[model samples]
Target: MKTRNLIYRYLAIISIALGANFANAQSFPDRPITLVVPNPPGGLVDTSARLLSEPLTRVIGQPIIVDNKPGASGNVAYQFVAKAKPDGYTLLISYSGYHVGNPSLMDKLPWDPVKDFSPVALLTVSTNVIAVHPSVPVNNLKELIAYAKANPGKLNYASQGNGSVSHIGTEIFKQNTGIDLVHVPYKGSGPAIQDVLAGQVQLFITTPPSVMQHVQSGKLKGLAVTGKSRHPGMPNVPTTAEAGLPSFQLESWVALYAPAGTPAPVIAKLTESVKKSLALPEVKERSDAAGVELRYLTPTAMDALLKKELPYWDKAIKSANIKLD
Candidate 1:
């Protein structure tokens, strides 16, 4: 009788704890929330976070604050979000470089992209453009390849860091084109662009948002964009395929993620908000103006995307023979 009573008491305690957790999830955002962006304050990820803050705060009846924690090719912020309580109050604004590609490039990543976080939404995809300093003497992708081959190690390309998507993409480009350009890694895209503009670096395969203004102002010569089709911001820019490389399509994407084990109801609510935000005309226009395409994906859709892209990157890494020490 004593053992049976003890078992009943343990079950009762477990049931009560679960019920309270569910209740807390249901009443999520009872206070202000924080959206931690894993990049600098002025980048695309931070801009997207600010875009969602106002409307989401209105819907949740709480202020949404953005915190920028940029480092480690975004591993610093990724780990911070991973270790956060499995509550909906703290969310992560993620990038593909941080979540998917980093794991494949590095020997050991501190957090498992899929297992450590729950997908909230895949928000937007901004294509990268291959731009060079005006002195490179290359007008198009084919010409650039010929120039690179002729010049050999005379040209150096800058990426945000080692293991970044920019770096990986550039490596893949080198393999595809059979060119050997030196790789220069910067602390972040901001510095990389700065050096590229100052002509300290001669080439860069980087996102349009970071380099669009320079392209518009004729500071950097646009070669080709890494997308399937034309972008609204640079309609005349040819894609890599159109420029003779069919296998070079890349996009700088941003997504929202929460610590794993966050409640299903909370995820649903967040996904709905994302869809709604993407559909807004203001958001679409603003994002487009910034060279970003406003795209929304359900959590399931995003999960499938992650799965597909992981193998693709793995193959690219192997093909390029890229190994980070």
Candidate 2:
């Protein structure tokens, strides 16, 4: 009789534990959710975060507030979300560069991009354009390569930061072209673009959205986009491959992540919400105007993408000898 009673008691405890977990998952996100943007205001990440707030709020029935905590190339926000109570209230809106590239460049990051965060969904991919100062006298990639070979380190290229998307893209371009062009890192895209226009830098690898206005005004010349296909918005501009640099291709993508300990059901729901938002016509239009290709990925697919990209960027960083420390 005692053994049977013991079994019943054990079963009762198991049932209670399961019930509590079910309750927690079912009642997940009962409060306002904070989407942390690990960049300063007025940047691509901040803009994307604001764009997502309304749609996500509507879908989740809770106000989704975007918080900008920019520093260490998105390490600040990553650490914040990683240590936040894993109750689904805090989230990290990470760019592919930070999730994939920083891990290889930064000496000691506070959070593990893969292990400390749960992949929720991919937001969008924003491609960059290779623009040079008007004085460079290079009409296309070949001319630029010729000029760089002759000038060598006289040709300096500015990027958003030391280990930014543009910096890495330029590095890859240099590796493929076998040219010697110096790299100049700025605080963010804003300053980099400003200096590039003022002729403080001879070349810039920047995103379309940030440079489209200047390119339109003829302040900066659009050389090539770092994508396989030309952007629809900038049909006149050729792709890196089309411009004669075959291996130069890169894009900045934003994705959602929660603390690793968050419940699977919570991740599923968040992923569904992001997917739904991306499917909306207005969301698609906004992303397109910003030169961002909107493609929502499931958590499983996001995990796969991170796994693939991490190693690729690691190799690139090592080959380029990039070290943030």
Candidate 3:
């Protein structure tokens, strides 16, 4: 009789807990939802968050707030969201560079990208552009590679920071092309682009948004885009393949994530809202203006992407001999 009573009590407690979780999921965002961004305002990640917030708010019937928590190459924000309550109230705006690259670059991380967070949505993807100072004496990708090869380490390349997509991508480019360019790391894209504009750095492979206007104004020469096709905003520039370096390609993406233990029902609700928001015409217009492609994947698909990219980045980082820790 005593053993039967104990088992009954345990099952009863579990039932009550499940009932409470279901109730919470039913009323998931009774209040507001905060989207925690890993980078400061105005970059691609923050831009992607703000772009979704307006439409997502209408779809979810709750206000969405964006919070910027930038530091430590995005580790600060990653750790913050990793520890947030799994109540579906706090979500992370994750960037691909930090999500996949950090695992390979750092010795240890406070959070596991795969284990500590549940994928909510895959948001946006943007390809990087290879731009050079006007004075570089090269007008096209072939000429640029030839010039770099002839001059060797005389060309200095500016990256967003150490372990950033720009840094690692450029290293990969160097390995593929056999050209030597010195690496100069900056805190973020703003400083890196500023120095590039002032001719303090001769080369920068960054997102089109950062260098589009400058390229248009003739301040920088856009030699090639590192993707399969040209960016709509810069239709005149050829892709790396078109520019004769088919193997050199790089892209950065942003995604949404909640704490690992967030209930499945709540995740389903959030995913539905995101799908609705991405279909909005205004969202598409704004994303185009911002130089990012609005690419949405279901939670399962996003998880699959994370799984596939993690080891790919690990191999790339190892090949590049990059270690941050």
Candidate 4:
């Protein structure tokens, strides 16, 4: 009789817990939702967040705030979101460079990308563009390679940080082309681009949005874009293949994530809203204008992508011998 009574009480407790979770899911986003970005404003990650925030606010029926927390090569914001309450009010704007690339680059990360966060949706994908300062006498990729080879270590390349995609990608490019350029790692793209524009750093291989306007203004000469085809916003630039360097290609993606223990129902609702927001025409227009491709993936698909990318980045980092710690 005592065992039966204990079992009844246990079941009742579970029932109440589930009821509370369901109620929370139904009333999710009673307050504002914050999208914590790992990079400062004006970069691809932050731009992606802002691009989605407006439509997401309309769809989710609450204010969407973009909070920039830049430091330690995206570890600060990542760890911040990872430890936030799993009540679906705080989400992460995850970047592929920091997400897949960090595990291999750093000795230890404060949080696990897969374990500490729930995959919400994959937002945008962008390819890097190789931009040289106007002072560099490189018209295209072949010219840049030749110039770097002739003047080895004379040019400096700026990266978002030590283990960022720009750093690894530039290293790989050096290996492929047998050219040496000193690395100048900055805290974020804002500072890196500023130095590049000032001719303090001669080159930057980064996302198009970060340098496209400067290229258009002729302040920065775009050598090549690292994608299969040309970016619509920068149609004048040749692709890596077109510029005689097919082996050197780099792409990055951004996604949304909730804290690991967020309720599944809440995740489902957020995913639905994201899908709707991405489908909006204005969102598409803005994303194209910003040089980021709007590509949406469901939670399951995003998980699969993360699984596939982990080993790829691991190999790339190993090949480049990149270590941040």
Candidate 5:
């Protein structure tokens, strides 16, 4: 009789616990949700975050305010989310630099990039392009490589900043091909592309969105893309493999994350909202316009990608000895 009574009590407790979880998930965002961006205002990352906010807010039935916490190479925002109460109120807008590339650059980070957060959904994947000014004598990647080899130190390349997507990618290209070109780090892509357009910088490996308009307008020449397949937006540009530089492939991506220890059901609700937001026509259009390919990768897939990319970038950044200012 005592055992029977104990079993009944245990079952009741389990039922109540499950009910609370269901209620919690249903009642999520009882208040405003903050999406923390690790970029300053007006950058691509910040712009993408704001674009996502509208659709996500509608799907989640709450106000989603974007918080820009840019500094320390994304550490400022990352640390903020890491230490936040894991109550689903705070979320981090994770990108390649903090999630994937920082492991290679920083010796000791405040939080374990892998453990400090729960992956929600992937937002964007940026395909990088190798573009040159119109004045360059090369039309394709092959001729460009030949010309760069012949010119040696005469060819210079531009990157957004040190330890950035462009910096690490271009360095890998030089490492694989044994090319000796100068790296000119700019405050951002605008200045870098300006120099390239003015015939001051000969080459630039940048995100398609930043340089695509210039490429389309004939101000910048598209040589090749650092993707496995050609991008539809720029169908004329060949893939790295097609351009005979298979070893030089690099892409940057962004995702949504919540602090670790958040309730699983809360994560599930946010994930569902994200999937729905990504499916919306406006979100798709905005992402494409920003030159971001929306993959809507699930949490599990994003976790797997994080694990895979960490080691790859670690090796590349270590070998390149990339130091950010």
Candidate 6:
């Protein structure tokens, strides 16, 4: 009798908890929502978050606060959101570099991108541009490779960090072309681009939006864009494929994530909000002006992408023997 009573109580408690969770999911976001951006202010990640905030807020009928926590090469912020309560109140704007690529590049991670977070949406993609200081004698990707091989480690490339798209893409370039160049890692793209412009670094592989003005002004030499095709912002720059490096192309991407256990209904609601926000005309215009391609992927598709990207990056990182503390 005592055992049966205990079982009955346990089942009743589980039933009640399920009911409460379902109810909460249905009425989710009664209060404000926090979107944690994993980069410093003034960069693309922060800008993307700020742009999406108002539209998402309006769609969800709640105020969306963007919190910037830029450190540990994106670990500080991503881990923060990963540990937050899975209550639909906290979300993360996960960059492709740290969210997916870090697993391969870093020796350890504060949180598992695939396991600790629910993929809410795959937001946008920005093609990375490869540019050089004008003083360098390289006019294009082929010339850069020849120069790098002839000069060996004399040339240095600037990247956001050890595992950033700039770094990974550059590393992949070196691997494919068999060139040797030193890597100079920065905390963010802003500082990195500054050093590149000042000629402190010879090569900078970053997004066109960050270097479009300098490229146009001839302060920096735009060698190639990393998309499969040329970027609209830098139409004059050929793509890596066209620049004779088809295997060495990468595009920086952004995505939305919630804590792993966030309720399904709440995730659905948040995904819906993302779709709605992306559909807004003003949002489209702003994203285009920012040199971002606004592409929204469903949660399932986002998850699939994460899975697909992991192994390719893993192979590259392993080949390069790259590691971050």
**TM-score of model 3 (CA atoms):** 0.93
**What TM-score does structure 1 among the candidates reach?**
0.88
What tens digits encode model 3's per-residue C-alpha lDDT throughout 141-189? 9999999999999999999777889999999889889999999999778
The numbered model that scores best in lDDT is: 3
Higher-TM-score candidate among 4 and 5? Answer: 5
Report lDDT per candidate: 0.86, 0.85, 0.93, 0.91, 0.87, 0.88
Q: Which residue pairs collide, candidate 5?
A: none
Regions of model 2 farther than 4 Å from truth: 1-15
Models sorted by lDDT, best on top = 3, 4, 6, 5, 1, 2
User: Residue 80 in candidate 1 has what lDDT?
Assistant: 94
lDDT of 1 by residue, 1-325 (tens): 9999999999999999899888987887688888999888787788888877877777667888999998877789999999999888899999887677887877778999889999989887878899999989989999999998998999999998777789898987887889999999987788899999999899999988778888888999989999877777777789999989987788878989999999888888788877876777777777776667777888998889888888888888877776664
Q: After superposition, how far is residue 128 of candidate 1 from its true place, in Å?
A: 0.3
Estimate, for each residue in 1-325, the C-alpha lDDT of model 4 and write its tens digit.
9999999999999999999999999999799999999987886789899999999999999999999999887899999999999999999999999999888877778999789999999999999999999999878889999999999999999998778888988987888899998999997688999999999999999988789899999999998999878998789999999999988878889999999999999999999999999999999999988888888999999999999989977887898778885
- Relative to the unseen true structure, what is the C-alpha lDDT of residue 193 in candidate 2, on a scale of 0 to 100? 87
lDDT tens digits by residue: candidate 6, 291-319: 88888999999999989888888888889
lDDT per residue (tens digit) for residues 1-325 in model 5:
9999999999999999889767876789798999999999875678778878999899998999999998888999999999998778899998887787776777887878888999998887778999998888999999988888898999999998998889988988888888888989998888998899999998999888778888888899999999777877888999989988887887888889999988888988899898998899998888767777787888899899999888888888888889877
Look at candidate 4 and tell me the lDDT of residue 178: 94
Which is superior by lDDT, 1 or 4? Answer: 4
Which wins on lDDT, candidate 2 or candidate 6?
6
Which candidate has the highest TM-score of all?
Answer: 3
**TM-scores vs. true structure, each candidate:** 0.88, 0.90, 0.93, 0.85, 0.90, 0.91
Per-residue C-alpha lDDT of model 2 across residues 1-325, encoded as one tens digit per residue = 9999999999999999878877888987788999999988876777788778888898888999989998767788889899998777899988888889888887777889888999899887778898989998988878999999988899889987788888888898888888998888987788888888989899988889878878778888898988767888778889988887767788888888899988888888888888888788888787776677877889999999999889988988899998774
